[model samples]
Target: MAKFTGDTAKKILANEINVQTLLHQHPEYQEEVLRELSIMKGSYDLKRIQAMMNKYTSSAKLAGNLIYKSGFNEKTVNTFLPNIIKARMALHLLEHASIAASAQSPTKNVRFNLWDGMVLQRLLFSKGFERKPVSLGLFNFCWKFVLNKKILMPLVNQKGIYCFYSKALIRELIRLIGDKKCLEIAAGDGTLTRFLNDAHARCKATDDYSWEHYITYPDFVEQADAKAALFKYTPEVVLCSWPVPQNTYEKHVFKTSSVKLYIVIGTRNPAFTGDFGAYNEAEQFTMELNERLSSLILPPSNENAVYIFRRKEH
Candidate 1:
């Protein structure tokens, strides 16, 4: 790793060199560059993220209060937000690093010490603030608190609290999916993908790398949109969560012959998340609202539901 001083760090932070070229020319410096990038000013707005969570979720008020009371003036917020932003970017950077490092050294472990995690890890485990997995139960607590805490924790710590889909849900998915390959699309930050992989599920994640504000495209997540990923991976099972409202890409999942099961986690209220239109119109598969598979997630408004689609039998 190149030793970067104050001047060089500032220059690097200012985007003085094209990041793409820098990475290509000095792949060894990717991790250091990413660390600098996190310190540089970034575009993530905690208020915006919090607003979305506040509007859509209700799971962690006690935790939220702890964050809101953290005495942040303008300067503090400015400096603090970058650290939070770094945590988000590290999501991609660490993944790419793992892949690069692993090729040369299989045990290569890339861990992050994030700024945000330091402020919020303790609060996540506080009582009266557990996240509910079922959709309808999502609205009962402050999900904004939990989500921000989660995003921030990664900024400061390598090991912290993690939420996953319930074991029963994972087991059911595994049982139905069997030994088939699985793919998750638009896998924001890949929390669920990690959960699946931890359980030894034959799952991989792909994304179009659209959320540039929060992350750089990770090498591990194949940088393809839904259609392209479907064609390339040709997975038998597809997974997605809260797809863009009125999304267009999910339709491509069913169009592929290799896909037999599509698992979606979103609201049952159905204001058009995950190409529900395509699922409704398609005749080849049957859709069911799975209550049993809704464990171990933040339902946000107690309205979260997992829609499971299976190919029709002859």
Candidate 2:
């Protein structure tokens, strides 16, 4: 990480410098951001948080080449997601500091634009990213208007080390269980799938495409429901990130004969991710909280957890 001075930090906060410069220099810039954010109570320099994330996400795709260039199963680098997650969570709380704030009834207008799709495709072929830590630097930049929770909160959540953490966890998983096909169901953007694929993990991504309005589903991702994907791919290892609560497709994974193990990346909040209903109801598999894998979840929250379900044939 580069030595960032208070003056340099101020300039970054003001957008005088490119966010990529900061991200490349310091992957763990989130902590500095939060520390500085304490003093930026009424400022709005964070307006560009959305645009910066757009570029960061694109850069993440480019970083895959670097990651792939590293030897297979090699842990190339660490990500700032733990700090980033905490910073974003704090930023969100800061954005809604007032008790009078109320949730807006979500409308159909919730959607992504062409930029989302455009960059996603470009990301697939992009390369030659800088050789340094990539940080979103949302907190690093100063703002221009009063922070708008409605517009910025989603980007803060959507953004961050989406492409980085998966590489670490998946490599660990495949290292544990070698010589098996892997399938990622409910793969929202296929970010994890792409990294794992690049790392030589025989993994393919599939999603039901229900969040098309919210996500620009990558061309690499097969547009199929989880159960159908399990049947079609017949993978031995199954993984999913943030599967919707009460979803049934994951339940069908166990029904498939080829699936020997299932892995889930989700929140500690019981109702936030994956299918607790299915995990609790099933009798054929042994479930355990995978601390090592879960510990790698971005933002490193108590809410993040990874579960491994190994089948026990009767």
Candidate 3:
């Protein structure tokens, strides 16, 4: 592990260095260089190094040649390789963080290993080691490092359990609804519920617990269908973030007399209208429902939209 001091971190931030440059410049650390290079080979562009190695020596003499070229005579290649690999891994993390920060949808298909690589790179660069291997490592490290900071949520899709939802989205939701009695239907793992609680809302997170592994925070959870739960809680505000397909139970809640406000977070696609035997009668249903509600707020976004309904004042 590289002991990163304040000065080292500052140097990395200033120069934007990484592990790749470090390895290339300090050829004397050939064993370390090779080890780091090997780990990052599949991820980054290592063709240049590979070509150099191929031109210089045979498979058996590879380690010997590296040591000779790197200017290290006393150290064994085997010992050096591990440290090099670790450094490279760190660099990759940094690279990932950099990429993630600049990304539009940062949570899309994020991987943990990639984030780790970026962190390593950032640490190395911060240490003021401006070598080729180190520089490349720095870029890689920043990319991966920022990725680690992301809030990972357990998503339940048709295929099964997966990770989705960005911290930004969660933050936005918190800001939207402050402290209120909230109900989240089709709440997988109670992610939104937890977010609501963190925002100081009196929220009850509920889910069917159908998945093999379900996530729930220390909150009230009832194993019931969305419609049934609505009848029990009759919350002031109802929130559903990305409800399952064809779940007409939402419509049932919309018609309920108890709900003061109903919020549906999802796309505008009509496919979300579940088999409540109501697609053909959507116009009639919506008109009747809208008549009952005082206010309705709809935002225009292809992937995400928020529908808010307010109860009519007596």
Candidate 4:
């Protein structure tokens, strides 16, 4: 019998080893039994993963190997590994009643909406699993997956400020706003604005008062009431991120003078406009704006719904 060393125990707890195979080979221990034992006998839990990750000089190399061995393609592995590791650790912690109870206590908790579809979309695309089983499964289980804070904490931390911008999406946005003063309407937390700012474009960020929980930058951030600021700024390029509210104010930005570009980042589904209760008005607004603006640009990525409009040169 192969004796389980601390290293072996750590690997087992990480799901690096097949639990069923371990149990089948060692009938004396049940699968769960082996998992728990591994945790107890080795520093194979959340803290261990974090500590070992620092010690490894080549974390990326090890990550690649793990992804390959786990039967995920490069993209899916890159996208999902950080979140998966975080989720796994969370589950481990939750399995302990004391920790779980403390986490559930109302006094220790506050409110924040987890980043849902966006995070999943990035993970799926990164792992090259955008078309794979894992991606499909993630889509199906998205609600449950993101509902837990533990899974999202690592992703929020890993991606830092640009967690919202997929590399491809950012590139596309940068290309569209080339050498232009850009305005991100409904720029929650200035995520997109930050990206544009980093790309060296002149950009301003704005959001409705409701998004106070998410919007962090005061200098760039402004209340979304268009009349209050639109004519004052006169942006050459205007951008809206997904879940854009179907409001007259959004349409008004398009009407503002000297606005050369209007970009809407969302689903192509005309239904998305209506489904969110802003459909009828937004559709009418889009039609009127389309008549005024020329040269529309749309990308084919199913994950992101993007629409770009260029003002007709007078």
Q: Each model's TM-score?
A: 0.50, 0.52, 0.41, 0.41
**Taking the tens digit of each residue's C-alpha lDDT, what string does model 4 give over 161-233?**
2123444456567887888877777565666676677767778887655434333445657765554456667
Query: Each prediction's Cα RMSD?
Result: 17.4, 22.7, 24.2, 22.8
The digit string of per-residue lDDT tens for model 3 on 44-86 reads 3334333433332233235434644655533444434334334
In model 2, the runs with Cα more than 4 Å from the true position are: 1-153, 158-167
Which 10-residue span in candidate 4 carries the lowest summed lDDT? Answer: 291-300
Comparison by TM-score, 1 against 2, better one: 2
lDDT of 4: 0.47
Position 245, candidate 1: lDDT: 43
For model 2, residues 289-310, the per-residue Cα lDDT tens digits are 9888886654345667888899
Give the number of colliding residue pairs in candidate 1: 26
Between prediction 1 and prediction 2, the one with superior lDDT is 2
Model 1 off-target regions past 4 Å?
1-164
